[model samples]
Target: MADYVIKTNQLSKIYSKNKVVNSVNMHVERGKIYGLLGKNGAGKTTTMCMLLNLTYPSSGEIFLFGKNPKKHSDEIYSKIGSIIETPGFYENLTAYENLKIISKIRGDFDPYTINSVLKMVNLDQHGSKQFKDFSLGMKQRLGIAAAIMHSPELLILDEPINGLDPFGIKEIRDLLKRLSREFGITILISSHILSEIENIADVIGFMDDGVLIEEISKEDLHDRLNKFVEFEVSDIDLALNIFKVLELKENEDFTVSGSTIYLYTHLSLRDKFNALFVNAGIDVGKVNLCEENLEEFFTRFVSNN
Candidate 1:
């Protein structure tokens, strides 16, 4: 019975003959970071656009803070901030100057707010630096500062770390974590960087070919990433029978593949499995711990889907 900050039901967008965004139901819980993961042309951006009311949905509904976005456009959007793709800024203006313009448009202009937000994003010292003179990371940081300057409760970032170096990426990642945990801000971030998303996101939603294929929590995803002990035996059928006798339920505690059985239980049970097989007169050829990381899991899921 947790409250969702953003929810979409059968949200879709079509462009002529192409269904850019198929029916997608997304859920973002309050004060948690939700990662939207997909490869290029997976409709991640389109989905964000619909939520932000930037692009109208072809069919379906969107709710922000429990109210329909179209019905309460200004009131609902005022509580949200977003950066889709590359953020545009007046190249000739200084960082502070650019944010001043945004603050004015937002009608929440405050000098203290500008300074605090710039400092928060590590752009305080660069306030006087022109947008054209800033580095890629600096520009991105400024974009984030502008997004959060009004202190919105929700943030939607599409590949915010797209061009950042390792250090910059880590900085942004830490900032995002702090925003969610400390400030209680809900975030929906889209990225092709599976590792970063895996490290930071509480929940992950995967999109494939414009379809939302799966949505799972980080802990559940780790469990689903195929971590187990694989046992190769001389007699496959006999091993399965032995497993059954041991009360190791198939497709639950173990799975079969040709001449091998993979135990889904922890590796701590390795000794027990070996002893059981050996006592049953089954020649256990090999036993090895196997696991798949997020990147490998994502690739496999996409290919299979």
Candidate 2:
């Protein structure tokens, strides 16, 4: 198996006067959840469409399982499944019957596969319920069941948690983790829900205005934003002088935001800085070590880009 289950090199797509996807490069490692995040109309969906061969790229190359997706779409896609936009189903058909039709199309009539996937997605009890009667969450789960029914090596979901309740979202989140960790399936999921993706994604790729800006592991984000003590002081000059005396300013490890300063060091210097402030007749009321969240980290890339 290839180290990267999906790879796109300098992919480009143009529409009339606008460039929908501009030379975006993506790498999805095997058996990992790689989240594609961006603002609305950031070309996230277009990029996925190109990868799945739903739309052809105007330029560049794409490979799935080390085979060209354009030339060998049917052969390569046999091992891949995707649910983009919305899950399509016959509203009148029951969940079981709907999945049964999909199974027939895949040429796999194994009733056990259908039942197993249904149970895995928590839709087993809704077997006789018509698709129209299923809730939004149940419908989403049923869509996932259809996607993985054939046991594809790769699963692509676009906004899997869209319009889902908190409980529903948590359920799907756990399911995706189970798919990656237990079944060893690589998932390429796109969503504007940064926090939810943060919980499940092993790797994250940020896309903006039709281009990929950065791709980093979840640990990399924590390591980058970690070890910074942010504080709000009444006197900015006094704080600067104290940091300078401590040789922290010499290393450019200090950042000022209005009346706040992020001491890019360790929390061990909490008492040291506090004492310096008191001796200097400066009052320090609130000092907090900022805990990094996915949204905060994601903002850095989006704004900078």
Candidate 3:
């Protein structure tokens, strides 16, 4: 329990007989980024709300830093900062000003931290920009800056990057990674985007239909991915037919996408397959051994169950 910053035991949340979160035992290691991943309405936000005490669990216990939150709400919550969806800031307030107000409200106003957090979120350059004028990505960064201004040991954010552009997503991703690595701030962030979480989280907890189906480390998930050999050739049909003649099945043994055909069977036969393609007068452009992506894994995982 001491090792985990946030630990849950059978945490369940039911609303009008529907279990939004059911018997989820989540473990968030100290100083690690834990990504709670699920599709919309998979009870991800509900689980986070339970952890923040925004809502109560139906029949489970929550432990933060090995202490019961119910017993030490003030002592526990003071060390945590969170953004549930979008956090509010004064529309006319500058990035620095909004955090100044937050710092004062939290009664830990340190002038140095105001600038430091802004710089960390890349908002220092836009220090004078009003919250209303900031771009969506900048707004998100400001929200993060406000969350961390007090230097909370743990930060919980729910779907923080749900509506950002590619550049915005990368901005927030790098910021979170920096917070975890440089500042040692433990983060519990939730998102429906598997690819984003796969990029940022140290550990991932997969949920569906209100149940936590799997919890695995990022490295372990990669190791468990299904391996396939992808080939790019001058002729797609000829290459595919070669496998077809050998009685290999589409999807089952291989799948063709665009100009490439992937082989799931005979994983070690890449060289042989390449030789066969070359002998068949097919120009082999390139070949790669790719693993099943997080999305592919999630789809297959849910389909199997």
Which candidate's TM-score is highest?
3
Instruction: Give candidate 3 regions above 4 Å deviation.
Output: 232-251, 256-260
Q: Over the full model, what C-alpha lDDT does candidate 1 score relative to the true structure?
A: 0.90
The pairs that clash in candidate 2 are none
Cα lDDT of model 1 by residue, 1-305, tens digit: 97899988998999997999999999899999999999989999999988887899999988889988778988998899899989999999998999999999978899999999888888888756789998888888888888899899999999999989998898889889988888899999999999999999999999988999989999899888968898999988878887777788988898888898888875797988788889889999999998988899999998998
The local distance difference test score of each candidate is 0.90, 0.87, 0.91
RMSD of each: 4.9, 3.3, 2.2
Residue-level lDDT of model 2, residues 1-305, one tens digit each, is 54999999999999996899999889999999999988889999999899888898989999888778768878889899899988999999988899999899868978888899999998888767999998888899999999999899999999999999999999999999999999999999999999998888998898889989989898887787646677778898878887877778534687888788887665788877877887888878777877767788778767877
**What's the number of clashes in each of the models?**
0, 0, 0
Model 1: which residue pairs collide?
A: none
lDDT of 3 by residue, 137-174 (tens): 99998888888877899999999998999999999999
Per-residue error (Å), model 1, residue 270: 4.1
- Rank list by TM-score: 3, 2, 1
